[model samples]
Target: MGAWFTHLILQLAAILGSSLVTPTPLVRTDSGAQLERDWGQQVRLKHLYMEGNSRHLQINPDGHIDSSHAQNFYTLLEIKAVERGQVVIRGVNTDQYLCMDTEGNIFGSTTYREDDCNFNEEQLETFYNVYHSPRHKKVLSLSLEKRPYIPNRELPPLSMFLPRENELPMATYSRRSSERETNDTDPFGMRSGQQASPKLSRSSRG
Candidate 1:
């Protein structure tokens, strides 16, 4: 009976042509969506340029988002794909995560909150992209007044951002320089002392 079973298994393997034990090949395609498709791959965005004022979106050391006149160190952002089509952005100079509120207010947070920090990057018709928060159901926008712009259901031009690639800056961010203690008892205050997002495999500090 054992010999008969072995012969049957061998016959099945022969008929299958070794496909049962062979692994399927993975084919990867590259395009403008490469950044979103490449999960865990980090990218340093030199200029998150918005067309409204022709200024770069800068995350200040105090965890505030503002428009800048030129490409500065504060405007340097390191973005990584957390999931397919979803990314978590961080300010390379301030050690803050780019976050958005339900009111469409964009800010930076020391602690990484998936609901606030994780954004679905949507590519627009103009070859630019707009970040949409699935949790808040709001889009990231910039006002001409250099303040937070509340976005309506209709995606405005202010929501579009052109990501241009350039060399990463050599300046390192000092966490100690901008450390602050705050309690998150309320829903608005999400700041905490976490080194990185729990979903990520490695430390985000680096």
Candidate 2:
């Protein structure tokens, strides 16, 4: 009985240790393939192209690719994020909307418009409110349009679907020492990096 109890205790300890050491499962696609990690944080679609005259396309991030009709116009594809932050979708001659969440629910659609540059601020605000909710939950949906002037076959590849490396809409600033060589003169007429030395000298004299 003593030996049996010792063996049971050892087994329990081993199980507990294994559980603690196990790692979380990495995110992956339906086919068990690994996706780009950086993208999961900021979802960006680089480009989307259509093969035929199809006016609409649906991207399912969790859907499987049909091997036999993989290239067909009706074929569905999953759009995964290549970066972090909120997913942004843009397209030529069309307006697009996205609905997705961290839980893997994603839906998108597009519609063509004559003035592609038009900005719908209200729609954008609503989108943000939904995506940035407290639950961090996302809905799956999209709205897009194809321009009437452009031929279906000649429509340019949708570059707006994917995020551009240079598309960040913000800027950053850096500090410069007074002694550093710069184009702009300081407002107070002190040379770059000279202010520190002058202050030090004055302090020593005092």
Candidate 3:
């Protein structure tokens, strides 16, 4: 009877230990819609101008600028570095444009268009291939004219420029975990302390 009771207690302790040691599974909702929403939220549209010509620019899904002149004049929108390349131009009007480099050199104006319309992905890619090719390094370094303009009214903040869908929550898991941790740590403000265990001294060891 004594051995059976000891074994039952040991089994219960083992089961409890295992349950305490196991980690809880992390659950995640559909991230595809979240990703799409985040991407759309980061999209920024701007108007670019060079040499008295202006065009509306949109940041494409691939993170490249879809310049209004992309289809008609691809050479003008060629970017050097794929990662850090950002389409920079003087506001919606005024001519004098250049492709800004990571090193701060603004390459000269390569193309110009009167109408600010019909720019798309296909045209941007074609232009990127032709003028930005390895063999065209010399043309990429040319200096273009520069024009400056001030906005008539204060431009809205960048956050306001983002689409509405992107404004939705993007980080649900972290938020949920944070809330859970907050609740678990001090649910009732109960004090946590260490329990004392009697220690044997050298003199008492004998």
Candidate 4:
């Protein structure tokens, strides 16, 4: 009986440990095949600027978001994972989150409002990130057109879907700095790095 009890306890422990393993948030090629070790690390994205224009995407003090040459704090972003593939890009300086309206207009908001700001961060062949909104939804992309940034729903000509004036560009971004201890943690969970991962499960009682 004693030996049997010990074996049962060992099995339970192994299952618990495996469940506790936290996966990384960053994807190597968006294939979801592999994950980087930095799950909660902070990262910066510089817009892929053209030759003569030297600017990164920034949110102005008035809450106007546009590409700018300045590489200040306003241009820095903290990526917050909302779910498996969805993330919200919040401006480090303004503390406001970036979201899109139903009309596909891009803007910054102080809080998340469901479909308004959530995006599927797609890594394209050009290595730039494309923030794709939901079906019948749109985001301001490299192509400044009215078309939604989803597959199969784009215009037939395909040229209209190409990068346009003031649209986000392919090879349009370069990532910088995976700072330590910058991960956003749950109020209930131990501080990042102290815990193997953030809260995988939640309770109402708290």
Per-candidate TM-score against the hidden true structure: 0.61, 0.18, 0.22, 0.52
Q: List, residue by residue over 88-113, the lDDT tens digit for candidate 1.
A: 78777677888876566677777677
Q: Name the lDDT value of residue 91 in candidate 1.
A: 75
* Residue pairs with clashing backbones, model 3: 50-95, 50-96, 51-95, 51-96, 52-95, 108-144
Q: Estimate the TM-score for candidate 2.
A: 0.18
The TM-score that candidate 4 achieves is: 0.52
The 10-residue segment of model 1 with minimum total lDDT is: 180-189
Model 2: runs farther than 4 Å from truth? 1-35, 38-83, 99-138, 141-206
Report the CA-based lDDT of candidate 2 relative to the real structure.
Answer: 0.28
Report every candidate's CA lDDT: 0.65, 0.28, 0.27, 0.49
Tell me the alpha-carbon RMSD of every candidate: 10.3, 20.8, 28.4, 15.6
lDDT of 2 by residue, 124-196 (tens): 2112211221122222212232222111222222212221232212221012222332444222122332333
Of 2 and 4, the candidate ranking higher by TM-score: 4
Instruction: Say which prediction, candidate 1 or candidate 4, comes out ahead on TM-score.
Output: 1
Deviating ranges (above 4 Å) for candidate 4 = 1-54, 142-144, 152-184, 187-206
Better of 1 and 3 by TM-score: 1
* lDDT for 28 (candidate 4): 60
Clashes of 2: 30
What is the lDDT, from 0 to 100, of the residue 81 in candidate 2? 31
